[model samples]
Target: MNARLSGDEKRGGACGTDNAGLTTSTGPRPRRRPPVPEESHLLKNAAIALAAAGTLLLASCGSSTAPSGGGRSVVDAAPCARSTAPEAQGMPSTERIFGWIEDLVGIGYRRTGTLEGEKAAAYVKCQFESLGLQDVHYETAKSWNWSATRSRLKVNGEAVDSFPVAHTYVTLDQPSVFSTGPDGLTAEIVDVGAGVPLQSVQGKIVMFDLKFLMPPALLALQIEFLWDPGLTTLEPTLVIGNPFVTSYATAVERAMEGGAVGFIGVLSDYFDSNKYYNEFYRRTQVTIPGVWVTKKEGARIRQMMGGGNRSANLVMEGFRKEATGRAVVGFLPGKSKDTIMVQSHHDSVFYGAVEDGSGTAAVLAQAQYYASQPAESRQKTMMFATFDTHFSGYQVHREFVRKYVIDKETPYNIVANVTLEHIGKQGIKGADDQLEITDKPELRAIIENMGPTLKLGMINSVIRHDLRRTALISGHVLCPIGALPTDAGFICAAGVPTASLIAGPNYLYDAADTLDKVAKDDLVPVTKVFIDLIDAIDATPTALIGLPLKSPLYESGAQD
Candidate 1:
């Protein structure tokens, strides 16, 4: 018998009055020393002294609240306190897992379909196998084919070094030259504020300061927010400097279709020579001739553009092709033979230590830990999958879900489909809206209990990610969209009930997303949360009563 929750059934009180699970702490927990007024005054004096010593600071220091009778400062009081089981230990260790991630980053950029990418896949496969996972395999999918040869910029015949942003278009032999129009192609420099508005950018290279100087998160968020709305109306033929926009593909397509001659993206000031060189050589192509200018060079160009240096030369060279990528798959069978799927993508844009490497590691570790459990402890069959081509059309995911998941004729019902994306960062920001489906109260209870253990918040409303697709198809409750820096939130669009864990190291896509960004302390807790969630789901009785068996005639046909 096939058992599933109807759309209406799934829309009930999944987020009921589980106030017992909620904490009412209004401030941060106190674990250390009480506040000292005298010390605060001394610190203020010290700050003034330091400033007099020719140092400038931008500190947001504040006065501390008086201590309570218990000798704990108001600022140091615990906001939320809950009882823990005596035998229950904290979540799994993220440090050990990050060590493995560091080793993977050491392998360099795992561009889709490359030898390095495949080798990385193999290493991941081995890791899963070592964890005792069964039927481990790789699935190939298509990826964009493009590579960069060389990029350079020149002003007044002076050569400048440049970096190539990923997915930016490059021209092979044609170098684009810019000139101010009317007589010599001259236009007044205009600060279009945020570059989202391109109404007045016609016939001139629109310049903006969207390049993030410190943390790339600011830029990533700006780009993600702007690209979806700005791309359609902004019609600048040429754009200069990284405006913190989406994929270079979008910019290139816009510029090309808009009749823009060329683009000059400014590299972030945080670019490391070694890292940039490593990542630059690892560039993949999309559609246009775009190049990255160094911070210094970009500054010079900005000055020249400001000073009416209308005649500037830019050139980019590259080509695109249709390439193939792969997704890895493995399975662990259970008593009922029904499948409960767990998935994370293996491919990445850069080193991707946090974007998804952390998620991948978590899934692999959970599979290992669960497989190590005694056979009697197992309940439903577990499907472990690492999808590919997530960055492109989400081809592999769509194919897999359509074929092996939804199309299966057996009584192999999908109890839960958990998809992990980016989960190695701190601070969870859920989607703008809550899912309309009703959640299984039992599942919500487990999640609530696990939240404190994992240092996570059980948010009712959040954005959709990879698992959203499955939710749409299966209509399962408890759908979660993992927190990350990117738009990997479309998973819930498919209607799969999902829940995501947030533990990312930093904003994704930028060079700052190295293995070092992942917090060692956060890993294990996130892992434990996933493991606990799986256990809870597996323990839930399937809504159905009978299990389907394969027939001898079907077996014979399969053999033939």
Candidate 2:
């Protein structure tokens, strides 16, 4: 039966792509290009270009090989040996995708707009160059950044381990063992559990178990579910109420408003939520020296100063500055002036092996697949981009539109968009890293370690980027209409056609999103469907590629 979708479904759930052509072992053999004067010129220019980009290359040719992710060159790049001659039927390879994973996540945590982020972008550029893509270059823009240099906490004259919350602002010097810097004052600890009182914690360090409030619409949905007990299916939305994703900044603001010297975040899920988790956000003016601790740590501090006046020291030195971030883009000319733009953000919060490294690897796989195919197979020009500033406000995507799409800066009319994110790792829904056992014996027997299923969005783009072709094709296979606007909203808002495939994993913004969290063998199914979608987009006519744009809810000319 075809999946019947309503407007209520939001983000993720299990679905099927088990159809003909989704997994065909054989495909049409591509035609090769005859060597000619133009081909000779192109080959010569490509060699010259690769020679010039040696300084920007990932590493030297003679670099020693190391184990996967252990800091050795995985493979020598074929930058100067791209042939226009057609290869066999090309598709994304899972093994090579994992190699790309080891390549990026092996580097380290790559927060947006940082030096590490720039280095990651450079690697992406090199990968594109190795794939024989032309016009591979870095598109850079200056953006604000945030970092936590040091944070210390002491209880009852004893030092305790602590970490600063990401994206929160702080500048407190260690004045004394019991008192913080110029901003903090001597006072007893306040155990304000998830509730903030503006006047109660004055001159005190307010440590609360960070509270998570679901966005209003999702809240109502859950209430309705309880009201109607027989309602079997859930709305396909990302509705988990986690404070790290939805509450960290708001709680900090409330604490600062209450005139607290420093703020402490007691992790809501001490068993699961790692204390090293970062609250990734844009730079905001209303920031306070904020640190997070486990629930056990909170309990220890509460016991230390029971019903008596005692002071504890808190120091936070956060790094904030404007830095240049780089985005890599490469072009493969096709049969038409129209374009298909495919992208994924490479910047990560921690090791980011999964939150985005998986997505980045998927993009690399797609690039390699496309490069291996004959250029004549493409009906539209293809632009592959690895973006930065994902943990930020997606400023890079916004800027790319303003300068190139809306500015009429380029000749290619980008008719479609294909975006990929977080397609690795089946979620183990318990604290001890165990699979959630169901009450029904039958269900448990058949369950396996499967990565979180992909959520394919079947929406027309509202803005500058067009990703509709890939999405429309997926609709015929497994695309559903309930995908939330986590990433595509920016492009869709611009009236572009877009297709997005993502796995809304719980550890998306946490340090626990390490390489190990990524699924080793689950990428094949997702890639198989992805290749089919690309073919569909290439064959579909432009007139039917996207839905007619719906009228805006409010006029842009009107002020708020």
Candidate 3:
């Protein structure tokens, strides 16, 4: 899983470290660091440093009582403690919130619909209900369930060792065997390095070096490169620079269009490790049979193609039907009954202990904190949701929003939707060091005031989330939220306003994306930021236009 890149190879790059040690990839250079032990210590120290000011407040409040000699309790002289303010009392303690995250990671991965996933959902519901919020329940939806069984690659009909690329939509189907026909589609080997353009793919199985550098342009001739001609018929035909050049969907579309059946791609520097697997699993959709060969295999393929062979046979198999999963939901109605939605997905590809267990924990901790507060302290009703099937084309999210939040006759005035995902890992190399705020300026300012205590920086980048669906279909201000780039990209594509925040680095989709990756200290600040954001939103007097008005209490039970 480790690939060494020389200094020249790593120029203008970000360095990344993983369980496989360290490496570089395409895109941006990862911020490099020392060994894990040192890094962990530094993170722990950073947490301590951040909490130093807050700890002093607790120190000043502590006092000891003494007993009277006559068996009667006697009051001991002590400095007057700081008054417990409403904000302090309403917000859950940092330790309590982080403890919940720890508890969740212990539960392992909760893949949608499994006993674990359901159990995690139930835990979330109970936390919401315990907060004294009313009408908490679960919303079920039909969804497709998928999991990879096995993946392998072979060269010249011989098995070559390989690893499953993250987020790659894989098929259980037999591998497609493609070969150059006897008449031999021949051409000189052209290394159209990275960033291959479409026009250059005429009759060759375009071979590009997997180096981080962009490839040289192909020379035009009477060459027949391996390109699906059918793609040429489409408006804005598939461009070569798109990272999805190797996507199964693109491949199948081209194949059916009677384009070049022989397709090959050099694994990008991004594939130096498996850390992106989870994100990949969540985003990739497979439509064709494909395999990811090693660098060596790619080089060999280039050699054979250079000798002028154009035909290849490919075999593919493995198909399954779609099914259903559930998104557990519960509500705590506030005095006003206008809503504030809090959400997290309960599913994971592997034991997504940190990918989202940390997120789920944050929501639950917030729920518990909100529940402990007096009834009147909360201005808006809070909806606690654990979405299922987020990875399966967002089916559950689409259906749930349409049925509950969007199409209702008496629409709830929702101020915001706060979603938490992948908040456990430390910062990754080349990752943005800010919480992407997708709200209007007024709301963004309110959030900014609460940022420092949580160690959160700000990124005003336009991104998407599941909330986008609610906003688009219902015109609600849905704030799509999370901590990683790929997930943020996914959310942005869905068109929801996104707030991206990361507690850790790029352990994203790898096997290293485990409980160990989560930093206990990061949870406290994240929880604090979320709680404050909710309060700030609730404090707004004017509701967004087009929401339903409140009905009289006496008419509460009347059916519409």
Candidate 4:
């Protein structure tokens, strides 16, 4: 979920320079790193570093031991009312929240650094202004803008449906993995299956299988940790789509090192469709040119390959340049200086009705609710934000963390964060091997890094709202990233207690994530739960809110 690339040199170039230069009725704004050879190498280094650090931290830590960056202990801080359930008096209605989703999805594919992305940011800013929120502005960061204008794969001069792999650096102006002009790359095709072939494939096109870790297989390994609140049948409903999980990136690296001119991926576990828009590339300087094909199409291509010697033409044309990444921000003043930030990203690969359209709606709902109340009613100020660059990279996220939370650049102090994402239906690979989306709400988690009191409050809120199939999962439990896996994961690691509600569905990154994908029925309930959570946090003292260093789920050192 994190964008690994750093733009230290190119950052702040367009921090306040909006392409449209349209000022809000109110007004203005504000604003990385090493060069890695390949994305695979970069990811390997990151994984090793994170894993080693986690092991070391877990080895010396106990279950009750809090991390170094945490606030005062429960013994020293004032306690909050834990037995009572929060009221949803001012929460937005389901129609109001879902309407935001419809409006966002209407502005097709808001990929970061594009005109559509800017439009999305503008829309969020307008929402904040409509609520009369103060200091509505755009916080910008640099992004490596890449968009595929056209991509094609032809076998024996016949066209085969294909989509360019997200963020693969393919251009004619630079020294990328496969640099071709309008003629494109014409070469012999070789099938490498799931393994990285050792045979010389110099100047040839490599075709390899890309596997996704099925939810069923993942549940078989970690079923004990999975908690369902008696919502529905607990079946495998999501797939681990990270290419790194299945070593697809490694295969691409090996192919590149083996002198392959280009590559084609057979989506072995995809839902019999090819319009896959995976953003796991993390904006690394990857130069490989690749496209994804469906399982059925892959089978046909394999059959064609068996006939005789054949050549294929791979054409992928896209623009890669420096672009601005924005984060729309505003604040609601309260009696206290402590701030509880409500956040979600506005950028998406496709329609993203659930990937984050639902999340943006959640943020809007919270903002609308809070702003409607008098300032004296709120104990802590609320910061409402919808970030960009989620799909491109996390540069904007990092920038916000640096300038706002870590640096305390603003007058308000951010004591906690609540992030919402992917409120959608449960999806699974059906009996016929097709993607089946169910009507029930997705089994989700409120990944939290809070103390005992706050944790109990979250559990109570979930139950009170009848948010079935949802659990209060510890943020530190078996997560590859040190904190929660949601957008608030980074902030949680920064030691501000965070509760991020999220779910993983099969169509999260695909064009199939339409308006119908959002769990419209649960919109009001989900918003109410967060409303209860924020009220609980505001009531509790900051000192007792966080648990910086908690033990992993297993003593064996795999963190959640």
Model 4 scores a C-alpha lDDT of: 0.67
Query: lDDT of all predictions, in order shown?
Result: 0.42, 0.52, 0.40, 0.67
For model 1, what is the C-alpha lDDT against the true structure? 0.42
Model 3 residue 324 distance off true place after TM-score fit, in angstroms? 2.1
Ranking by TM-score: 4, 2, 1, 3
List the lowest-lDDT window of 10 residues for candidate 2.
Answer: 441-450
Candidate 2 structure quality by residue, lDDT tens digits, 1-560 = 24552211100001000011011111111111111222333344444344234323313421111112334332222232232222212554455566566556644456665545655665676567656678877677665567655677776677766787766553332111222354433455666777665465667777878654542234242121121122321422234443334556666667777777777777654344434555344434435566778766776777777847457777766576665666789988899877777778888876677768787877877787887778998997888888877765566766775555555577877666677777544333464533332221110000001111212211212111222112122221111121223444344444446666554455566656655566655555445555655666666666655642312411251101
Tens digit of per-residue lDDT, candidate 1, span 70-124: 5643222222111122111123244445544544454345566554455456545
Give stretches of model 4 more than 4 Å off. 1-89, 170-179, 214-233, 238-246, 308-310, 477-483, 549-560
Estimate the TM-score for candidate 3. 0.54
| TM-score result, candidate 2 | 0.68
Q: What's the TM for model 1?
A: 0.56
lDDT of 4 by residue, 438-511 (tens): 87877777777777887777777777777877766666453324534577755665666788887777778787
Which candidate number has the best lDDT? 4
Q: Per-residue CA lDDT of candidate 3, range 1-560, in tens? A: 23553331121011100101111011111122112322433344444443343223222221111222334211111222222222223455544454444434333345554444554554454344434446666677765544434544444444444444332333432222222233323333334555443444444333443332211111112111212223321221111121211333333234323333333445544334322342323333443333445455565665665646533333332333354566666666677867776777766654455566667766766775676667687777877777767555555765665465445534555445566665543322232222121111100011111122121222111111111100001111222222112222222223323333322233434434555555455455556656665666566542421233222221342111
Looking at candidate 3, the ten consecutive residues that score lowest on lDDT are 12-21
- Alpha carbon RMSD to native, model 3: 17.8
